[model samples]
Target chain A: MDKESYIFNKFKNSLNGDDGAVVGKCVYSKDLFVEGVHFRREWMSLTQIATKSMLVNISDAIAMNAVPKYALLGVSLPKDISVGEIDELTNGFLKIAREYGVQIIGGDTISDEKIVISITIISKTKNPIYRKGASNGDLLAFTGNLGDVKKEFEILENGGKISNDSKFYIPNLKDKFFYKVAKFINAAMDISDGLSKDLSRLLKVNSLGFKPLLKLSKDELCSGEEYEILFAFKPKFKDKILKIACKTNTKITIFGQCVELDENTKFINKCKEHHF
Target chain B: MDKESYIFNKFKNSLNGDDGAVVGKCVYSKDLFVEGVHFRREWMSLTQIATKSMLVNISDAIAMNAVPKYALLGVSLPKDISVGEIDELTNGFLKIAREYGVQIIGGDTISDEKIVISITIISKTKNPIYRKGASNGDLLAFTGNLGDVKKEFEILENGGKISNDSKFYIPNLKDKFFYKVAKFINAAMDISDGLSKDLSRLLKVNSLGFKPLLKLSKDELCSGEEYEILFAFKPKFKDKILKIACKTNTKITIFGQCVELDENTKFINKCKEHHF
Candidate 1:
């Protein structure tokens, strides 16, 4: 086993091995957004950085079909950060929090060389979707489009101007649509570390394999930080799920189906791992 | 108002303004321990650093009369951190977590310049004690002793020899005794930013004042990072609280009484403000 799996297996009985930890009726999730690793200071304003940090964590809770409620923020600021910039960051946090009805209750801050924002979101859910419940014939689906983020990333990398309204910085999550179809879904996970990587994680837990039916580019399959929901359901519920997606104004695409593990099934394992 | 208060007040209605956020029967708390701010790399081993990070966050939950159940860790490691060091850190986390019965659920890790460990502990308590319930004539008390931590800190800072079993690295918490007195306590908070500063926070919320009778030294009242529980109760429950403390093999010190605000009563605001 790798280092993370070895460590996680030590306490596997108590852990849910899902996007968030299920404790009673509440689900707790945490995410870290480092300055140079996740985004550069020159790429966006501090306000945008703060907003994105909150959204990424909120998305994790949403992926579990949970109602986002409370958030605890941990921030490490550089020496050159100004008071006005701190205000901007606070406003950014408050703005997104207010939109989601999540209260920023408590947090800790300290001095560091660069900005490190860590957010932990607590939400409520009765029936949480786990990544280990997919059956052999369950259909795999994903919300929103893929591969577009890589286009924006390339423009930013080449010192080119991308649109200010790019979805890369601010992802439009379809949380309500997920809630509408929560009971029908068998398994789900957020596509933060790309579809191929996250799908491998979801399938490995159940000793299953996948065969893609739709054509997808390499960028769509391997690019990270999509923040979209990838889920599975029985083929019989396809029409109901599609009806709900239409009613909630969400775009979902069926891409693959879970199958029994065999030598002929090709598994993609070349995706990026966020933490080394 | 200061920056932190101004920011907190904006969401004060939705917050409890306590050591942790109260959601249903669970209390969630988050804290950040950054290298060079909380501890120096040369002063301790990676195990000590990792253990201290978990303990400090657990201390907050204990102060609220909560039984710690789950923990989510967010770690930012430097590039030079080896796999063996990661194992050491995980062992440290597992060791302390086992002692508190807090299961390591899920977390995210990333690479950064310095080692930043942010821990979020979720604990349960049916009746959580807040810092705004102290009334006039209520007795103020504290667990364990103070002023000794400064001596140990001085020894460490001066490059002198100190015992490896120092309380500066690991605190002995009396969580059971606190739960026994949870119903009787009126107000409480952990003495993290020093007794004087934290006491000021506890009383300011209720428009109350405190006059210490123990004749504590400046170091006792002003030293930060002393994770002792400071609490208040009616004078009528003092005997019962002392009885429980004695039965639990814990020490209790009654040092003051809550009084009405007046010019004769002095307030000490000299304690450290961690995030300015």
Candidate 2:
């Protein structure tokens, strides 16, 4: 197992393996975006960095069909950070919070050698969708294009610049489509850690596997940081989902269907792990 | 102003300066404990590090008169971290959660060069006490002894050893006393950044100053990471607070009273700032 999975499995019994933990009507989720580890300072501006940090966290709440209500940010900044940089970082967070109608509650700030941010998003969901609800014969689909993020990531790593509109800079979360189709979907999650890896998790929770309907390359299958919605539903709801997708202006890709687990249940992830 | 305060001041209109943010009946708080910034690995075990991180976050909730119900931990581990060390780290978090009847909901973990933890505690409060309610002539008091944590911190900095039971290792939180006296106290906070610095915040919010009733040295006044309760209450409830303190087996020292601000409203914080 990967180190992140190993560490997460240790607390499996005490915590849920869903996109976010549900307590009553509240869904709590946290994500960390650290300097050097998650992104290079040269690759993106502080506003882009901070904006992605909040968006990725908000994506978790949206995946759970929750409306993010508030956010608490934990930022570890560098010692020589300037006032302009601080303004940019705070403005980045404020802009996203305003767009999502999320209250910037409270958090802690400390000094470190790099800029590290850990954000907690508290969302509300009257009808929450967990990752464990997929069943046999359920149609599985993902939103938007995938392989593009991996291409962007490689370009940035090689001293090449990508467009400001790259998903690496700002993830296009499918909150509107997800919320409208939440009641129709059985299981769902945001594809932050690529399709294969994240889909493996969705399958594992239901003790099921997938039968791919469309052929996808390793580049597409293992593209991480694509904040697209991966979801499953009864095959009968496919038409309804497609209708909502058009209404919400979302591009839905019907990639696979849930099936009984096989001997090859393990999904190979060739993408470089972002954490370690 | 310090960089931390300056950054926070920019968001003053949006976020609360309270120990935790109150959203309806829920209180949310986040705190970061980074390696080198918060402690050296040589000075603390992984268990001690994890334990202290959890306790400090809990202090925020308790200071707001809230009971922590769920915690989301964001841990950044070194690349060479071992399986055994992961167990020790998780065990530390589990132990505290069990003690407080808190659920370890969900969190994100990543790889870095050193251990960095940012924890978000979601607490519940029927009636939360804020830092803006202190009135003129209200008495201010702190729990337990002060200055000991600073002495221990200096000892560790100089390669000197201290007892394991030092307050630096395990802060004796006044949750029991604070909860019982929640209705009586006008304002409250935990003194993580020294008595003088934290007291200045409480007074500033209430538009008040303080008159010291007892003599205190710079060491006692400027000791940081003490994690003791600093609170204000009306003089009429002094006896009641004392009675609750005795019943709860807490040490209460009434050392100051709130008064009108003077030219000396600017309190001197000679203690080294924890965050730049």
Candidate 3:
């Protein structure tokens, strides 16, 4: 048999309910993290590279209020990369997944022009929380501050100044804070395409328009990699949220709330006053 | 709500269940087809591109002995590629899915240097056939011939030599006879790497070696597009298989039966024999 055939056959034997078998519904989610678009390997350690690649989707699942369980990875490497480098990257990922109690189910390897890491995570929960269930009185809240990531992006892009505070703020403290806040929302989603674009999407899908109270600070507020999560809840669930937060020692921000359920989302932040 | 949130929220509302509405197992298989590595756009029509892309995966479910159900597609395209081109490409895939009674549930997209299509298929079946299931005394057989795809690949690779009847004849007949033949095999798999390589995968998985009576007259065959299936059967089901084939009007090739389990497989076809 060919080398490829040997690999596939090993994969085949790995299946079945024998020994270490774990099975669930057939799901697949892929994340292709390119060099310039996702991360720079220089600034981030291989551990961070593997963790960030996994966490983005974990955040997606968290926004859906689902428990992430399994992952499949596709790694495309340049011809010059070494086997040791590849193994280190995967080992880093393995360590993180084991930390989170998730399994590295399966993955693929291929040759590419750059390091394109395609990760697919399969998660489960009793009920998946979506962004469509917000009632008229729902309170729109965020897990952390929104605008700091754009500042980080600017710092990265310009190769300019990045405070230890700025670096520690987004990826370290802010990210940890949000993961805990994931399960507390009725309908939740992350602010990936900036608050403006993402909130617009939430409004469009829910078919509800809310006037956002955007009268806070404007700096680091416009747009950037705000991996922060924004979720909604009814006023009655506020106490439950508080209890969960208190137990976990996780901090959250209300940023804005569900002000109305009319047509077109009228949002407000430090940058713009509302009028729809 | 960004497009990501918008699309997901739509999906959630469409399928409402609290806590855990539905969560699927991530695919057991994931593969990539790249430009210059797999197929070129210059040769295949839009329909063929779509059909072939999805068809490459149809038997993967069969490879796992699972019922092929849903597909998640990841497509990366150049900036010059029109939206119309993408729509045409997707429509071709949707057409193929419909043919297989499958659906394209969900997937993501991004930009890339060359066209790269990565697919993950979710198959549903109670008792998924596995390559490791073939025991000693199991009769090894294939649903179709081996040499046709090799012939076709040669013709296509050599600048589409229309004058070469030798290269094209087998593939043309194969195109007509392939799918119907696919319905008859047990533990069937598509002949991707070639019978020699693929059979090696099968034997190793089953922990049994077999005689490869490959009556193939060609040497040095390497084509990534061969979708023919190979399978194993029990002696008790022999009459049932013949009856089914007779009724369905499909040919079943009894290549070589499994004699005793061995690490190395022996080849015997047309009174000639060899071992590796």
Candidate 4:
């Protein structure tokens, strides 16, 4: 047998130990955080860098609506970096892992010209909410509002201070209320790549789209990392979602609705123009 | 209360899906393959790149004694690359996933300066083999012979010609096994930066070291990319392990024992020391 086939066969057999306990099929995901490309070290702290690195997957796992269990991370850094720096990053990582109840079990470390972080998060759910599960009549909604991150980016880009102006960058306090809202979500993914791009991805995956009642500006369109979930659900749950959001003092927004497509198509903003 | 603690806790709880079922406690690992830095695009085919990238973790998972399950992969490529070339790498990754029963459920992609593939693999096992598990009294045994990969590197470094015409680099065959041997070991790891450097990591993690029963030379000490498992077990299992290797048709090398100390207690090789 070929190498891949041989490996999978062994992996399959290995799952069945002598005992009755059997591990389930895990839906796995991996991502990279590169210096300058994925993030800038100066803009964020070692703690923020580590948190964002971990959070990237936390957002992804939430997107799938699959309960995440573990994270394996690998990092390559320059020789000059002190062991103290690495320890700080690990503290950040372990803090995140312990919070999510996921363990930082194992990983690899090597030397390279730049800092590169690779994170793998594994989660399993009996009924994993996939991008394919969106229905034609589903209403599209977002857990939080946008424009703030765009505004924050603008402030930082054009000498605006985020911390000094609180109620601006992250406006709403969506704590426990937002968690409750997540349960009712049919399909969810963060608006990591502004509304225009991620909206395209979320729709393309489901093969559905809608006419946006509202159009976002260029800044809103390309805001790189919003880190808020955009979900699609039946319109009936709208009120319940709002009520839950209200309970936790978080904001909720209804961006648009999941509409029927004549052909096997992708979700686009132009509703009447649902051309395959 | 601290920043790291806050992010991890929220992220963790979100991953568990408090409303219902949860996936918990997983092992996820990631490695970055940089062209030229990590691998030369000119030297390796896309398929080999893909396979090697995946194999790095396969060996790692094997070292940890975990059944590899999921992968979070990121490929930052040059914009000039063709879709077909990208597909070749993707197919290579998918092929390995199918083979290892690893689910490439999700990850990220971007355009960058060079082709940077940061892969994170997730795995689980009730008993994870850790570098810290080995004790001073344990006998250090290794599966598969070293010096083979060093031979390949030597060939490349010296105009791709081996001094010994008898040397080889074929995928399979008893005389030259270049692939990894990661199975049934107490605590294991791949030899990426030669035995001298990599062994130091295993020894450091556990605050342990070993001595040599048989004498060795410089050739045997600093062997690189020997992607085999260096494990320590009770001497009583030595004969049984030899039989196991025979049954598996794998090679075994009793490189040395886990010693007490040396010039550097982290790792002590009775073999020749490389002094600049």
Candidate 5:
């Protein structure tokens, strides 16, 4: 197991193992966007960094079929940060929060060596989705195209600049689409740690395997920070899901089907872990 | 204004300027504890660090007269963290969580240069005590003794070690007393950034000033991380508050009364800012 999993496993009883933890009608989730580890100042602008930070967290709530209502930001800023930069960052958070109708509540700020933003989004949902409800023979699918984020990350790592509208900077979450399709989905989560690794987690929790229906390349399977929805549903609702996708203007890919764990079937995770 | 206030002022419309923001019946708050900025690893154990982290956040909820029901922890660990250390940190969080009956819901973990914990507490209160609502002539008071945290912090800064029972290591919150006296409080907040600074904020937001009933030392006025309650109440409830304090075994210090802002009556904050 990776270091993140190892530490969280110690709190296994309290953890819901979902995109966000559900309490009553509320879904609570937090995400960290730290300098150096998550992104470099040279790669993205302050607004872009803050925007991605909020969107990545909002993705968790969307995956749980929750509408985010409130946010608490923990911003650890460097001592020498400029007021203009702070404005850019604050506007970045406010812009996304306004778009999603999330209220910026109270939070703490401190001085640190780098910009470490930890945000908590509290969302409300009537029927929250979990990662353990997928049954055998359930059809597995994902929203949006994958593998582009990996190519963009490789370009940035190689000292090449990508476009201003790169997915790495601005992630597009399917909040409206997910809200429409939530009732049809049995299990759901966001694909932040690539398709292969996240898919394995979704299946392992249900003690299931996968039977691939479409060929997927390593790039498609291993791209991180996709922020797309990965969900499972009964085959009977396939046409209804397609109709909803069309109505919501969301791209859907039916990649595989959930299967009983067998010696012949292997659901391997070839994606590299994001954190230690 | 300080940098923290300046940055948060950019989003003034969304901020409630309270210990925890109240949305409907739920209160949400987030706090950051960064190594080197908040504490040093050599001075405190991992368990102590984790315990303080949880207590400080819980104090926000308590000060708002809300019972902490759920928490989301954002932990950034050093790359070289050991499994045993992780266990200690998790246990420390769990121990405090169990004491307050808070559920450890979900959080994110990442790798960084030092341990940075950002915790978000989601609490429920039927009637939250805000930093506003104090009127002229209302009495101001604090719970527990003040000035020890500043001395302890100075000792630690000067390479002097303190005892395991230091208030800097484990903050004793007046949660029970606050819950019992919440109805009597006109305005309330925890003294995290020392008495002078935090009390000035409490009064300034209400368009009021202070009349010092008792002379306060620099140490008492400027100590940070006291995590004690600073509140305002009417003179009619003063005796009732004192009786509740006696019943709860809490030390109550009535320091001043809220006064109309005047040139002669100044609420000078001599406390040094905790963060840039």
Candidate 6:
């Protein structure tokens, strides 16, 4: 087993092994954004970094059909960061916080060579969706468009200016849409570590496999940081899900279905695993 | 104003200006442990680092007289970390977690050059003690001894061994004693940033000053990471507090009292201020 899996397995009994930990009605999630690994200061402003940090953590709670409530931030900043930059970062957090109705409850700040922001979001959900609940023949769906983020990333990587309206930096999460279909979905998770990798994790937990029905681009299947919800449900809920998506103005696609593991079935494994 | 205060004051209306943020009966606290800033890898083992990270965050909850329930850890590990080292770090976390009965609910992990552990602990308290409630003439008391940690830290800095029983790594928290006097104490906080600096923060919020009655060494009042509870209570509760401390086998020292700010009053500013 890899180091992450090895360590996780040791504490699997105590852990729920989900995007967020469920305790009673509350769900807690944490995400780390380091300077070079997550984002570069040259590519994004401190404001954008702060905004993305809060939103990425909030996405986990949304994936679990929870309303984001409180946030605890831990930031290690560099010495050269100016007072104005700090204010901008704070404003960035407050802007996204106001949108999601999440209060910046507490945090810690220290000096370091690089920026590291670790945000922990606390939310509540009566019935949180888990990745271990999908069954055989369950139809899998994903929200929002994929592959566009990879396109934008390449543009920035090739010394090209990305459009200000690009969704690469800021993800448009369909939280309301997910909540509306929370009861209808069997298993769900945010596609942060690319589609194939996250789907493999979800299927592994349920002891199931997937067979794609629709063709997907390499970028859509491999590039990560999507922050879109991928869910599975019985084929019977297709009509209901479509109607909900239409009403909520969310774009969802039924790309695959859960299947029994066999030699004949096709299983995609093109996504990169996040190495720690 | 200093950078930390300047930034915090911008959101003071929404914040409690306490060690942890209070939301209903729950208190959330976050602390950052960055390599080189908080600790050097050469001076301590991974186990000691992990243990101290959890203990320091738990100290905030104990100061508020809250029972720690859940923890969210964010670790940015270096590439060179071995599987054995990770296991040792996990064990260190579990050791303190079992003692406090705190479950590791959720967290995030990533790879970086320096190890950064950001711990967010969620705790509950019906009546959380704040640092703004001390009235004029209120007696200030501290738990356990001081100045010893500075000596130990110096030893470690100079390639000397720190005794296994040193309180610098694992603080001897008087949780029972604090809970016993919770109703009687007016103000309280943990002395992580040393007595003088933390005391200044508490007094500034209340628009008051302190008059120390006992003589103290510079190391005792200035050197930080003491993690001892510094509290203020009415003089009428002195006998009751002593009885409770004695019953709990805790050492309590009455070293100062709250006073109105004036030119004649002494203000200790020898403590180091963490600038971010």
What DockQ does each candidate score versus the true complex, computed on alpha carbons?
A: 0.62, 0.76, 0.10, 0.24, 0.78, 0.68
- Please state the i-RMS of candidate 5: 1.4
How close is every model to the real structure, measured as TM-score?
A: 0.95, 0.97, 0.77, 0.76, 0.98, 0.96
The C-alpha lDDT values of all candidates are 0.85, 0.89, 0.55, 0.59, 0.91, 0.85
lDDT value, residue A255 of candidate 2: 87
Off by over 4 Å in 1: A1-3, A272-274, B1-3, B271-275
Model 6 regions more than 4 Å off: A262-268, B266-268
lDDT, candidate 5, A132-246, per-residue tens: 8999999999999999999999999999999989888988899888899899999989999999999999999888989999999998899999999999999999999999999
| Candidate 6, residue A183: lDDT | 92
Query: Where does candidate 4 stray beyond 4 Å?
Result: A1-27, A66-69, A82-102, A123-127, A154-175, A209-222, A263-276, B1-27, B98-101, B124-127, B132-137, B158-185, B200-209, B258-276
RMSD (Cα, Å) for all candidates, in order, is: 2.0, 1.6, 11.2, 8.4, 1.2, 1.7
Q: Please give, for residues A65-155, the per-residue lDDT of candidate 6 as tens digits.
A: 8999988877878878798899999899999999999877778777778888889898999999887789999999999998887788778
How many angstroms is residue B255 displaced in model 4 relative to the true structure, after the best TM-score fit? 3.6
* Between candidates 2 and 6, the DockQ winner: 2
The candidates, ranked best first by TM-score, are 5, 2, 6, 1, 3, 4
The interface RMSD values of the models, given in order, are 2.3, 1.5, 18.4, 12.0, 1.4, 1.8
TM-score (chain B) for candidate 1 is 0.94
The digit string of per-residue lDDT tens for model 6 on B182-267 reads 99999999998888787777777777777888988888788789999999899999999999999999999999898998876646
- Structure candidate 1, residue pairs in collision: none
lDDT of 4 by residue, B1-276 (tens): 123222233334332211111234454455667676656765567877787788775666566656777665667776566656766777788878888788764456666677778776666666555565667766776666667766676666666653332222222222112122223345566555567666666777667765767665565667755666667766666777777677778877776667665564446544343211
**DockQ ranking of the models:** 5, 2, 6, 1, 4, 3
Q: Which ten residues in a row have the lowest lDDT in candidate 1 chain B?
A: B1-10
TM-score of 4: 0.76
- On residues B1-276, what C-alpha lDDT tens digit does candidate 1 reach at each position? 255565556456656578888877888889999888788887778888988899889989989988899999888787677778888888899999999898888988776788889999998898888887899999999998886777777888999756777878777676888889899999898888888888889888889877777777788788777888999999999889999999998888898988888877756687555555
| Candidate 2: segments with Cα more than 4 A from true spot | A264-275, B264-272
